[model samples]
Target: MISESTPLAAVEQAMQALLDDVVPLASESVALGEATGRVLAEAVEATMDVPPFDNSAMDGYALHHSDAGHTLPIIGRVAAGDSPLALERGTCARIFTGGALPEGADCVVMQEKACVTDGHATLPGDVPEGDNVRRRGRDVAQGSQLLGAGMRLDAAALGHLAAQGIDKVQVRCKPRVALLSTGDEIIEPGKPLASGQIYNSNRPMLVALLEGFGADVIHIQHVPDNAEDTRRCLREAALAADIVVSTGGVSVGEEDHVKAALEALGELNLWRLAIRPGKPLALGRLPGGDGQLTRFVGLPGNPVSGYVGAWLFLRPLLGAMQGCTAMAELPRLWATSTFGTSTGPRQHYMRVRLDFSREGIQAHAFTDQNSGVLSSCVGADALAVVPPHSQVAQGDLLECLWLKA
Candidate 1:
């Protein structure tokens, strides 16, 4: 188990240790209608060329390049979807957009340049070969790998699959996650709060965030501060889902029981990290309903810390379970700091908004860096990483992570 005083760098190592034991879920074929946002389990190859045949890129006259400036007989007209026609030596075809080029035609001249009168078409001089023509397989070649395994199917991917006549695709199953919110002081929203009780906002926020990440929340329950109750809820979550995420009950306080509960059922792989607001996080695995191991992640109680923990840990964990290699790292962009702050012993994740300027993007940290303040995240564009024990001055370049899609 990792100690509470472990360095921030070790936290990443511990996270990787947990990921090394992750086993991606099984794959299944799904219809195109339900494939969006799903990870592809198998690579896709183009069965046919994108264009399939040589076609016209515009409305023009299809003829041989050597026939320029010569009045050729207009033997036939071809529109889109028309079968290819054979052209004779002094003849040209009047073609519309996407019209298939005839066998003997090697070039196309725009209709504005090709004046047609009666049954004859006149082309201008110097009309280059292959002009205004889209060659077969120019965009995508047949038998080429178009999409690789573990790719998240978005609109463009779906369209590419449709272009290849793929009605169904093999994709990884969605991860089933269980969320547990602990602490006796936490009360459900819309209900009157008793003495010293506050409304629970982490449940809904995490639920939406997990759903946005393409995870299915199989169970979401509120566990009290009692150790026995926490253990029972954790056991149920481990049995019901592929991953169990718990908020609170990981600190060293007497009320914190998540770590003790995890130790009872399994091992706590990690205990704390050297990061501000989200220092207390636990990761482990426990026996699942099927006798396999179920992943467990314990997040801090503070709302902001919980959000950050989920962003840095849970998102990538779920992605790994879905076999997405790209999601192994968080998306980061460089930005100049518009403001500065004195550093402490731990790494700081400041909620900030980014401003685009002529020079470069700039990050401006929120006034209140408190973990419990949810207002700081409302207009925040990203979480700017500030290293420990370093003084940051204005105009300093910093690495910023995107918080929104």
Candidate 2:
């Protein structure tokens, strides 16, 4: 393929290659205690109705709607988890919150609204029909699926499941990922650095990024600029993980050994993207001597490039494995630019801070967006995607994606 194709073409190639190979991980049944942050491997349907029976919504007198605005004698008491009892005719029951209403009661008056004295409650105002009563199946009906097979389990989901007496769930096994960084100039943090050595921030950031995306970050390390060492590292990554993510040394620069190592181990395609911060991306399969294959992505070492590539690539990769349709999609919006801009042949994703101003959503660059600058990403709110060869005046429509908080 010619190197001068459009950016979308390159993105499509990389995305297609990844999509063709990302098989779903194994399935596991786990108690709800550990289901948080795990993807659902199967749908969860409510086997029993929520609330189980007609219950009071407030601590008050449970009475018939016909007794509204009438003073009825409280003859029985019902608290939460108690058996429902019959309420005598022209009588009411003093009920506590979440307590089942008496068999003849259909509504509840709030405690503050009804004056009670010695087993008698005077209900005065016109109470709406069935006021403050939660009927069976109000929260979730039996046989209705509340969560799907591929949904991400969140707090609300767990609460819903608990309401229906579900204490366990089946969830997808988290994908195992191995992270590596290539370059002789990179070193471990907290160690003495010689000249031209920088602390390895990419490993930490990438590991966090993978974990946040639902992948179990298994192994992480830095490989030197030697081809043999890089090859050995790739072998370990491919053997121990379903996907290998590495930064730096994919370009044509001397001492860049990652590309050669990948070629020696498997089939590789290097992409020249039209996006700023990250343009040189290597994507393909790692074929082992035993004929096993694993996916690999080689991203630029520049912090912004590495970060963006993860968003644009790693997100989709893991999202496909989980079967979430929306997770892989790029979020785009028309943001009002605070400054004029022009673009070269490459598409530019300018780090921006956004605010709601007089002209509505106003966006300005985070800093002088040199691809190598890392601090500008600290408070970035969005990315203004400037199209190739396009010019925009101040206050013009700029497409942007909101950064995850």
Candidate 3:
């Protein structure tokens, strides 16, 4: 329902509509060693307490608090992983870091605070009870929830699982993506180009983006301007992929036949957006196997346009398909603008380099904001947002989306 003049909010709503139809993939069991970056499909609970037993937190003399300020006999040593011994009421135990505390000991005096002689140790004055003791279950308690569903398993999570003796986990399957590029004037990279022909840059860029986003690229195809051929390719892609992303041939030109082929195969939910650098975007659903619907995203041919469209549409769609609904909207934080801008009817997402100052993060827009100028995106860390029919002066606060996000 959006056109080129629609607001960014309306475009976001249309994008969400397409995502609402996607279903998360089924879960499968994976070894803990291979679970990094995979989405957790089930909540994980700790079977045992971290630091399962009460132990010493440092290398010190373990003794009863009442024995403080007294030169006590060093009856035994309890190093880490060694069996704990019972301490005499007036004696101490030589314990190393992470060592077990003796049963009769109620406190630990750090080695620096205690004077150790040939066979005895002198404790500090008035040492408190429970000093230098790491209590059992102080970290993770038994039966406590460790990780939640839909969370990505990172290095920290993996270490936590290893501490709990977990060897396997259940994770969501990666979505299968079909990538296509169209245009008679476009040729594949690494091949000689004819006169008036340009190499296809959007496909490689999109494929890399999809890989970094963690989706599995199932097929990569290039099609010409033929309508019948486009329709046939669409059907085959929908049958084989959970989502299809294509670049070029979705606009109003006579050679643009992707929209028509999509309309014939299924339903078109969105055809345009109100954002600069990428206004010719198409979103739809195609008939899939087993009565499921395969999502489709058509981005403009220009490299900059395709990049913007990917961030605005394809990323959110992939997130939704993986049950990450919170990623439907990008974070928009305020930043001071180093330069001014005059906007027109459509919303503008200007590439800018971010600099941190005493005031805060500042956005500096590139001199060239043209859609076809892909080089402008280099070294830019964020996209500074400019609303329609608006103007701003230098030092004005503007909202921006971080590129790394």
Between candidates 1 and 2, name the one with more favorable lDDT. 1
**In candidate 2, residue 42 scores what lDDT?**
83
Q: How much lDDT does each candidate structure score? A: 0.88, 0.82, 0.85
In candidate 2, what are the lDDT values of residues 1-405, reduced to their tens digit?
323353434566667876885667778888988888778888887788887898999898888888877778888889999986898768888899999988888889988988877777888767777899999989788989888878888899888878877788888788778899888889888999999989888888888888888899888878988888999999988988878899998876778778778887886765557678788778877863356687888899888899888888898888787765566767776778888878888778888888876757888887588878888777888888888899979878898887772
Look at candidate 1 and tell me the lDDT of residue 162.
94
Ranking by TM-score: 2, 1, 3
Per-residue lDDT over 154-187 for candidate 1, one digit per residue giving the tens place of the 0 to 100 score? 9999999998899999999999999999999999
> Which has the higher lDDT value, candidate number 2 or candidate number 3?
3
lDDT of candidate 3 over 1-405, digit per residue (tens): 434464343565666766775677888898999887777878899999988887899998999999999999999989999998788898999999888788989889999988878898977788888999998889899999998887777799999999999899988887899999999999997999899999888888898878656688999999888999999889999999999889998888989999999988898888877778787888888998899889988888888999888877777777766665545667777899999898888789999988887979888899998988888877878888898888989999999987685
C-alpha lDDT of residue 54 in model 2: 88
Q: TM-scores, in order shown?
A: 0.93, 0.93, 0.91
Query: Any runs in candidate 1 off by more than 4 Å, and if so which?
Result: 1-9
- Measured on C-alpha atoms, candidate 3 has an lDDT of 0.85
Better of 1 and 3 by lDDT: 1
Q: State the RMSD for candidate 2.
A: 2.4
- For all candidates, the clash counts are 0, 0, 0
Which residue pairs collide, candidate 1?
Answer: none
Q: How many backbone clashes can be found in candidate 3?
A: 0
